[model samples]
Target chain A: MKARIEADLPFYFGPGRELFGFYHPAPAASGAAVLLCPPLGAEQIRCHRLYRQLAHALAEAGFPVLRFDYYGTGDSAGHGRDVDWTRCLADVATAATELRARSGAQRILAFGTRLGANAALDATDAALAGVVAWDAIADGAALVGELDRMQDALKVDLNRFDQARPELDVRLEWQGFETTEHLRAQLSVVGLPALGPRTAWLVSKGSDAVSEHADRQGRSVEAIDVAPRWDDIDRLEMAILSHPLIDAARRRLREMA
Target chain B: MHEQAFRFGSSRHLVGIVGLPPVIDHGVGVVLLNAGMVYRIGPFRLHVDLARRLNALGYPTLRFDQSTIGDSGAGGKLLARPEQVVADVGEAMDLLHQQTGCRRFVLFGLCSGAQNAHSVAHADPRVVGALFLDGYGHRTLGQRLRHYLPRLMKASVWKQWITRKRAASGPRPPEPAFVVEPLPGKVVGGQLADMLARGLKLDFVYSGGVSRYFNHVRQFRECFGRLADHAGVSVSYFQESDHTYVLRGDRKRLLDHVAQWMGRHFPVTRPG
Candidate 1:
């Protein structure tokens, strides 16, 4: 239980900024290190409790984990634009280094949700260990399309303001807010399947084709819907304390042994 | 949209569920090509709900995962080829006709599946019309190459031997299971893209062009456009919904129109 808690470990990537996170070092000889990437937009907000549960679970299991913010968001470096794949991946790399140096764990893994899953899978060609995705966004194009549909649903007409290639940056009367070109560019090429080495895909619920594709690729897949755990704020604290990943750290160490 | 389960090929035709029909036949049939990896999906179960709904409206439909993608599992690394899909549509039409004596049937597809449907409906006379949900155009290797640079560069990006893959990769809780390879010169690349290029996929056809995601959206549009001109027979884009925008009602309407078009085109001879 005397797990070392490193809050906001500052790690450098490029010349731009140092990304950070809170590392919960396991109580025993550590098993491995896991960097957790949160979801995108609102889902990020909704899954905070789940991430906490995941972090505590990993810690209890004896594998220290560092769940950090990308360059700009959270307690990390920059802004939303700073959250692009380039910056996000760098931040993840930096986090892995920090975990390895501090805990001397031989293995490491990337556990990501939604948009974060893209970064994780894309990291297959990176160093460290394997990657796992939770409801990973297999189709980046779909997410962009969703944003557009949501924009339409929101009644935002970017076309009304300027006739000739109107700048989407400037807030148009109809468009609720300016849409960023950076986010768009990222989504176009965003594909987890293209990323090297297949990553495990775990659906929160329902067994569908994506998971089947995971199986085809020889990746482990499990779909467990834990009664939709995010809504229980009062239970969030307790839930985090008894997370499965955290509970399996010692067993994870035994596997390594 | 509207469809009924009926029996055709002798009760000993294929697997279990001895014939009456492997599926409900309303004389109307649609060969659905899911984007890719259909075996992992519940196509008949998912779209069957829509079929059941459509059947209530006096129409019968069949939504089967193309060869390699779903339970049909007959292709190699990819799902059925364009020509093969066309052939399947042919068989499905015959099955529908023989079973219920309805001649009219439509071929409908979504994303990459749309391309399959388009190719089949154009080549075959039986499929009078087509319905495309999130239709796509085309794709060239060069365009794909340009898009893949970021990944290539990011791969060897370790500062010495210290770092490995991202730290966040770990096993996620599993999902429930109900459950459920390759030939030479078969398509292979980025896993999903290879699968799609081989056959079966979707894109912005399901999403928007947020600047961050604009590349994906535009690339998809370009790919869809590429395939459009070649879609010989006329195909209609009904109920265009973004990634989050799948309107069941609109999809139903699209199916209704498809059935009507089939009736006008194929002219099924009613049983005497």
Candidate 2:
């Protein structure tokens, strides 16, 4: 077994170079590049390690990979409140371009999890060769509802010993990240867009709706039981380092190539 | 503000971002440590927000991940997690010193990061100050009374107690996979005394998340006794904020408080 080389080059690109990303240049280029679109907020934090691992795996398998934080999140410029769904889509496109330019790979494949998957599907990029949607969100309203439930549950857990404080009349926010009214409206209307022929749907075992939706769209779906529960409060701090998911993504991208 | 990404360390695998101001005003830069497993951005991007704010105040800031965390790889030399963290942080200071000519530094952290900050500040003579959010605290008699008395007066508490007693006979909830043990009061007090004697400025902020062990402002005085009253020590207790400061308002309050504290104690000398 050879010791894997990690992504050594970290750079800023996109408009005003506001976006931060790590480029994992493949020792042997496969003529295809992988752009990892990360999930939003807390989900992004949970998946950070998994994404890094996936990037490494993809790079070793001969594809250059670029993983980045969308604007208003992570090391990128802007605050959490500035996060917009449309902006996320644009960032995905921008990152895909950056990855193509850096790797000199004509074919670009996007691998995104959760909301990131949705962004990849919706992004209008000419260079996108394929997409791997891992547990992609099919319904935006459902995600909002789930996040709201998690927020309420978190309050109950934090205030277990004391009486709950009066709810503050403030803008929509979940966990620590704030969502603008525009983004909330955008999320509420999110539904599965038409899947491309090269799209790969990797969903959790219990997510029958996503699989059925893909099947209805004449798209095949791979159900993996090892997918991390992104919204589980108990394992909020735990990183999603599921090897099965990482391997499945790598294999899926290789098949696409 | 200028932000630059860096990959430095012995193996040149450690990753960090340095936030620089247009004009350098202070000789002491700020270095942020990772809070638990979360990356260099810190929980809710707190480190990024803090670094930018500190830069606006004319102080350079570096937030980096420890080895095996975030983008950072394992060190070339094999060492335990504790020693690796200390070494990683020292290298961060060294990087800032080399890049920006910062002779002294202030360390800031939250939760586990706070523990690391305490460790590094104690070991490194170049650390001029350390700020800890929801850091170490032991339950003193005052804290225990403050935590329980309000609940004892509430009727809902007794009802919940009765409900829990009935439920306790049914089934036990699964034990947590991990538990955080609080540091001993005696040891923390002694460490604080030593740091104070060395003229290290210390700031402690307790949030509602740690209310079980630290509830009121005076709990600091009761927990650490004489050391809490030292001129070099300052404490703030925000009973409304959770451990991670999840709420946007809570996070803003935290950032503002931190900036003000830095301005007061570690005031940046303006360039002529």
Candidate 3:
């Protein structure tokens, strides 16, 4: 029998910044801790319920989990104007350190979805035992292009009637959330060469960019195909737990353990 | 405005953010309830923006997650009953009252949140006013004809009808699921009458998202009987905006309207 304890606390990740997070402690230590990195904008709101469920499930499986919002997002301190890749990368590293210190787990696994997976890949260091990147973006330019297409699909043109368009330095709007030009530049050229020995690249159906990139690098990667439910614009509020996806990720982690 | 995160409830499991202005001796404060499964932040973080604006207006607000939702832990159970939600809200009011000495409160909620706020207002005497966005509204016979008659006279409707008739020979894809659950009209009407009789201020707003059931401005009275005509009750419909004010302009309009309504009904005054 496993009893999980959950706490909502703030992580002093940086100077004058506090990131909000929920820590789910397992009944017994599996010597491994997981940090959940959420995606940005509407995707974060839509997948929040699923993330909580995943945290609970992982805790039950003996992996202490910590799920959090990036700085300037969710319940965290700071404004939208401050969101950038540098800050996001630092936040991830800080969250992992906090989890390691709190859970006393010798091994650490970072799980990220979408842009979060991109951040996870960038934040991965020697201490990270393994990584589970779900629906990751391998190329930053492609990610920005996809976001542009998604915005067009949603019929959102923030500057449609503006006779005078602002410069590229101005922030861009993504599905009602603000993104700075600095963040856009960083995301335009992101690349994930290949994962280390213990890495899983979960790609959506009809797209294997990450897997192909890994293969091109002459590296072995666990490429698992899943539906792109995270990008679903319609059912963003519906908490549809994909058992197959969860089971696949779980199997990979179990093998690592 | 000063904002702080705190927890209060049985076993201190409910987590909430209390927004207080520089002055804390206000008599009437505000409490924002959660909308369905959406957390205390409300959809698109609307509640946060609303609370900040209200605090600037010198009215303290407390927005919290119901047990089993958001940052709050489950109250020793997986599912929370309706009564439990009301109790949690009452506890929030109690906490705010103890903190600010506020005796009167105005409840704000949207969608399922509107239902919860209405329920709390009905049960708690401290709730002086309630603002409901995209709340429960029903259609009347006249409204039904008014809605369909225009389409009946449309050339596109007839053309679509003929096209569908021609395509009826082929297999039809199952109609996609569309869930619509409107609250009971009679019960809401009775409650409205009672609240109005006690001098309770009511602001009920419906956006274009709920136009399927409530389209016309006069539909409230027709649907819920004459009780909707009470001077204490105000009904408004934003036909162009959706259920959640996704557009920035629409949200500004809503906030302005709410600020004006709050000023008129539950004005925050300096303590003597």
Interface RMSD of each: 20.7, 2.5, 5.9
Residues A1-257 of candidate 1: C-alpha lDDT, one tens digit per residue: 21122221223333443453555567765566777777654344345456656765667666677776665444343433334667667666776777777778777776777677777766543464766666676677776766565434333221111011222222211112223577677766676574353355666554364576687687666664544452222121122212543334223323433
lDDT of each: 0.46, 0.83, 0.72
lDDT of 2 by residue, A58-142 (tens): 9889999999999999899888888988888889889988988899999999898889888888887635888898888877898
Top-DockQ structure, candidate number? 2
* Better by TM-score, candidate 3 or 1: 3
Residue A242 of model 2 has an lDDT of 81
| Candidate 2 residue lDDT tens string, B61-121 | 9999988779888888988766887899999999998878898999998988998898888
> Candidates 1 and 3: which is better by DockQ?
3
Against the true structure, candidate 3 reaches a TM-score of 0.83
Over the stretch B1-272, how does candidate 3's per-residue lDDT look in tens digits? 36666767765778787878778665788999987777777776678778878888888899888877776766654444667767888889988887788888899999888988888888888889999987877777876887677777877667757876889566444534423354578887788778888889999998766766777778887877776778788889886665766545566799999989988877767622
Worst-scoring 10-residue span by lDDT in model 2 chain A? A157-166
Candidate 3 clashes between residue pairs 3 or more apart in a chain or in different chains: A141-A188
* Docking quality band of candidate 1, CAPRI definitions: incorrect
Cα lDDT of model 3 by residue, A116-230, tens digit: 8777778844256777877777777877876665544443322121111222222365554667778889889877745443667776674567768767766455545533354
Per-candidate TM-score against the hidden true structure = 0.39, 0.93, 0.83
Better of 1 and 2 by DockQ: 2
lDDT of 1 by residue, B75-150 (tens): 3233336555665556666665665565755555654555566466545656544555444433456445654565
